[model samples]
Target: SVSVLSYAVIFAASTKLDITRKDSIKFICTFAILELVIELLYISYYERKKMISLLKGEK
Candidate 1:
């Protein structure tokens, strides 16, 4: 949602901001990659915590 809003704002202001199509694509792609990386880190952390809890239960 935020990404879309930002994209919309960038596009709406593109003419005034003198932003090129290539730059806009790059910005959107960067945001997507960063979001994916963050999501993966969170998932990894949750899985590790779950495994630790399971191991503790086996004691």
Candidate 2:
């Protein structure tokens, strides 16, 4: 829901600011990739202990 609202705000701002399509695509794609990388890092960091235990075949 936050992501959707962010995208909606970006779209609205782009239209109001008269940004070009190519620039908008580039900006949105970059934002999305950055968000995904951050999310993955957050998950990996928090799950590291569980993952290590699983790799050692623990119950």
Candidate 3:
């Protein structure tokens, strides 16, 4: 899953930087928020195109 992969990457980076758990969690949360926004945009675009195609097919 992307969530697991993202968390794993964050933890690895944090360890490399010698940061604390708090900082790592903060980065993970920010990344999740950004991912949500991007996912929404992607879904919206995909659905819009699909509906347009279906409408065209009906006509």
User: Which numbered prediction scores highest in TM-score against the true structure?
Assistant: 3
Instruction: Assess candidate 2 and give its TM-score to the true structure.
Output: 0.73
Which residue pairs show backbone clashes in model 3?
A: none
Error of 2 at 4 (Å): 0.8
TM-score, model 3 to reference: 0.77
Question: What's the distance in Å from true for residue 15, model 3?
Answer: 2.3
Between candidates 1 and 3, the one scoring higher on TM-score is: 3
Worst 10 residues of 2 by lDDT: 10-19
lDDT (tens digit, per residue) of candidate 3 on 1-59? 97898789878988789778898889888988998999999999999999999989953
lDDT of 1 by residue, 1-37 (tens): 8877976775666546667878877876787788789
lDDT of prediction 1? 0.79
TM-score of 1: 0.71
Query: Whole-model lDDT for model 2 versus the true structure?
Result: 0.88
Best by lDDT: 2
The predicted structure with the larger TM-score, 2 or 3, is 3
- TM per model? 0.71, 0.73, 0.77
Better of 1 and 2 by TM-score: 2
- List, residue by residue over 30-57, the lDDT tens digit for candidate 2: 9899999999999998699788889999
